[model samples]
Target chain A: MTVTATAGQPAWTHSLFRSGWLDGSALNFFLEELNPAWSLVRPAVRIRQIIEETHDTRSFVFKPAWGFGRAIAGQHVGIGVDINGRRHERRYSISSAPARGLVTITVKREPNGKVSNHLHDRIKVGDRVFVSPPQGDFVLPSPAPQKLLLIAAGSGITPLMAQLRSLLSGRYSGSIVLLNYVRSQQDRIFGAALDELAERHPQLSVHWCLEKENAERFSASQLQQRVPDYAERFALLCGPAGFMQVVRQHWHEQTLDERLRFEYFGTPQPFKPDDKPAGVAAHIALARSGRSIVAEANQSALAALEAAGETPSYGCRMGICQSCRCRKVSGPVRNLLTGAVSHEPNEEIQLCISAAEDDLVLDY
Target chain B: MKKPHPSRALSPQEQDALAAELDALRDSVVADLGERDARYIRRIVRISRYSAVFGRIALMFGFVPLLWPLAVLALGVSKILENMEIGHNVMHGQYDWMNDPRLNSQTYEWDNVGTSDNWRKTHNFKHHTYTNILGLDDDLGYDITRITGAQRWNPGYLLQPAYNVVFALLFQWGVALQDMKLGRYVLGRRPLTEMFAKLRPIVRKSGFQLFKDYLFFPLLAGPNLLAVPIGNLIANGMRNVWTYSIIHCGHFPAGVRIYTRAECKNESRGHWYARQMNGSANIEGSRLLYILSGHLSHQIEHHLFPDIPAHRYPEMAPKVREICERYGQHYATGPFIRQFGSVIGKFFLYAVPNLQRRPRTA
Candidate 1:
């Protein structure tokens, strides 16, 4: 299903121009001006179609630019969109089967989400969006497991849908039990598609859990009763934090954690200093200015710096603009958005969304 | 060079009022930044790049009478726009909201001999934070000439008039070397090994620049080797002298105030804004000159809002001037000739030693 498309460039010319005197900038400029889908470096894609998946969610089908590569099913890619002249990048899980020519990403509108709202309302077919190569290890493994269980809630159904379609389309011949929870049928993404898929596929079973109806809430005992062989199935979980927390606890209690894989979206809850023992505070060093300030475990590096009366240049206090991105010469910092703890030395970090986890030196 | 009459200093409450008003103006402009500002910068980039490419091509045929001068002019325009309107403003994080990697302050490399990394420290952080404070801001005279009486007069400065011409002609070289702290190394304060280590990046950057302008492009011209290199020299020379004049006018002009390091310690936001206003001068010019100067023509407004888009400085200037006037503050601005002439006048004035040790502040 993957296509190996390459932008034509003479190897000798590329090597010759690779000298330090020239940058890809000039070529990138002309390429972007001629057609947004053309670029020397970034993988720019054009929106081929917009699919209305639900009342609140829409799926965009993208035709990759020249030299585009294939993405694995059940993986996420960072999509860059220009809204109000400012470029904002957000990671979206691919919601389509891994195939050549086109890729689809389902976006759910969030009230305060700038990029999401633009994707939902302003963006149209044919607009170009810059995309990062598909990433994340939440995809189905090679030698697909037999008797799989996929649990998704609300918009979380996107990635699971990809995996489900990929599995049904000759990747796996095993049975898959899909558990999808939504507020109502109106909010259920891919409701009709799931129904059609279930009707055509004999080994696939789809369950719809609507919170608006008097459907019983998911429980460990209920799951055991519903599927007697649940412990034997490799399970993929995606939902709100509370739902995932409940499932995680149940799996941990049963010592079946090895069989369960989960992914959550949206702004991650910051590390709670109150939950941790004392002495979790971080010391932040401004390398160029030769100043140091202590950041409480609860505060972001930017907040701590501002509180200490240092005016580091910043814009859009959120991580969207990357204006406050600085070099972290050394330290551990937890990204407030993705909840990823970075321990890499001399890495670039956004001060607005990163909370220092230890003594940190920044090239500020 | 006669000093202008000092304006009345404001109290803390008055200063706070001025800051709040100016801050609100800045907020309004920031809120309104959108497609127009983004388009403006991109257009400038396009024009700059096109000019550079076309100029080089034209210079390949520079043996023709009309093409030589026109090619050099175009190339000069390209370099000026790249360094000033584009590179300088973008390095201030002005277009960071656009989120384009090409315009990102920390990562952007300009068509200059100076490395952008060195500039982020020497210019963006130090020069800005300590605008006109003697012994703090390296830009006070770029550690070469004494612009302010606050700096101790040394015997080396007696040849400043001659050095000023050389510095202006090779202005970019001076800026590129500013962060190297060559003086300290020469004075035995800095180690030779450390200085050489720092020189590596500068050498690499300058090497590529020299190669592109002098050797590579000219060689690529095939038969027009001599003409192309001469065109590049003219272009680079034009940019150097022009930038030198514009920058000197904005900073070292007569009537511009200078401060001491002690005077700026623990400075309040209002006082800082006040200092930036006092320490900088502006040149009245046409729209073309404004763009050519990267809107550094509105140097007072630029110093106040270093992070704001330079294109917006023109709009912000009158409002800034009004605020200064209401606060009984001096807003220095004049025609380019007058301002630049005063800057030249200071070269001679400070070349001879300040015989009497006056108060530390100027």
Candidate 2:
């Protein structure tokens, strides 16, 4: 049998061939035919319709021109737009019903966001966009959420809105709290529709939080205050980067099992903040001399340095991508993962994930 | 800096001692975490910082490293070019707590390890826990292989490396038979609900992701379309072969026992651990070896302390061995090259249930 038949093999894939295994032989047939190479799924979607969501937000309904589906909701697609000829991709949550033939994705223009801004301005009703099908583990289980809190800030509500619409249209008999956060009254998405849904359901409540006009910052405390007592209320929060950060800074900190859900608005770079190398404070203190040296755990070392006020040089942050890699002169740094430490006795470190463990001096 | 080996073993007493030690060694490992590690990191930071500053200068100077090479049809090692090590490590949950040291973030959950409900219970649990337990370890002819009485091989698969796409390109016909034949034989009578509920989602997405990873990127490797796929084909083929050799080398070796459930239960925990050691092969626990196999060389450490991060195994190994030695249990281990030979011997010893292999037709 060929690899095609056994295609869905587990992806613990690595060196399956040797230096000369595929050389000058019919086994080359198996090499190319059986082993997984690349190019399976991509976005390749055609926009079918558009719905005005808010002042800055809009829902773009798209259908795969080819075969797709077999994917779930909360799953995201990497939509590539050919703008100025450089193909740029932005991963967006599939805000549409999985049962529906076409998947819906709602995009809110980022004020200074590159792709988001380009998409909002240039993408049209009949545009064909390249996209990867639902690439995240963010979908809700079927049977609908029993008591759900669909949280959103800015346009982060797109996916949750999709979930909400799917659950409601499917005759879901559950209570849902839609915590909609916006800068002002002009920014709320699906506002009137939510209001009407809330009026009819009685169990569904729409908590609108517009920060500029709502006086108090619609914060975790306020969120906590709203859902004060519940043995089982699932929170699906989304929004602007800062807004989601704030929500995460506030939501269920003491637990990780079964209560919270996250649909981050950032690229999937393993959205982790805990992998900062040891002695971050010490380096911050050292780098702080005459320069603002705050450790941006979200960034590479060079990125953090630049953000901190140092002009630094770098390349690809991926190890093999060796663009932003540098020579380690001295000092110990802990690997963000596996928490292993490597000392100065080496060539260079990948600063993208490396953090200093002491008050130190860097080459640049 | 490097991945810890996956086959590190701990004596019974050391296993108990490790649990206690980890609880107490919190933050204390930093003291012994030497200057070499520190300097290596700082240098990387420095080089990275300088490279960024200077690369922009170079780009301004009209120095396009990759682009210029792409011009000459012989780009040196574009396979290494596309390999996303960061993505690999991040997927393994390595980067989650790299910053805060508090493990405050949740990493992308893979098939095995951790108690997170999200992990797809692929043959991972079966392959690792049961090793070569035939009729139980569905890993042999799982969702990947094409056995007898299975999906007929499609010639179009020669275009791409992964089997799924070859199958898809031919027709979505053969996958069911392949899955049925192996999945039927290896996936024993666990609760049907357990399979559907726990494993289905992971199996579903992973299958598609496999196609995407194998076919999607290669088909679009670069400006030259064929260059993209051909390059991917080479890289992916190499990666798969290495993975296959390392994997089968561990369990199929001679002297390893493939026990039934009754045999497994009757053995004491120590003996059971010994069974795992006996069943699996140990590669060298070198830094480089750990990396190539996702540190699975410390398979014993992996089995003993699945929850403890893989990096901690090297540090804990010597201590673990001391305890195992004291217990007088067979803590199986050997260099990787030696283990590889053993596995080849075992491969013949425990032949795959071949009645299911596809029939040869003229």
- Which candidate wins on DockQ? 1
**C-alpha TM-score for every candidate:** 0.86, 0.36
TM-score of candidate 1 on Cα atoms, chains taken together: 0.86
Interface RMSD of 2: 18.4
Off by over 4 Å in 2: A1-43, A219-221, A228-232, A241-257, A268-364, B1-362
Off by over 4 Å in 1: A1-21, A40-43, A66-68, A270-364, B1-5, B355-362
Per-residue lDDT of model 2, residues B1-362, tens digit only: 21222334555565455445433443354334433433432343233334323322222222345632232222112211111122123333333223211111122222111122221122223454555444556653343443222223444323323553343332212322322343543467455665565445445544543454345543444334444444334434544445555554555443344444554544444444555544554457578566455455666555544333455556766665665455443455678777767654433322333334444422
Q: Tens digits of per-residue lDDT for model 1 on A192-225?
A: 9999999999899998888787465689777887
DockQ (C-alpha based) per candidate is 0.34, 0.01
Candidate 1 per-residue lDDT over residues B1-362, each given as its tens digit: 33555777778898788878887888789779999999999999999999998899999998788988999999999999999999999988888767666677766778889887777777777777778888888898889988877778898888998998999999999999998879899999989999999998899889998998999999999999899988998899899999999999878987788887777777777888899899999999899999999999999999888878999999999999999998989999999999988988888888888867676553
Estimate the lDDT of model 2.
Answer: 0.48
Worst 10 residues of 1 chain B by lDDT: B1-10
**Chain B global fold similarity (TM-score) for predicted model 1 against the true chain B:** 0.97
Each candidate's iRMS in angstroms? 7.3, 18.4
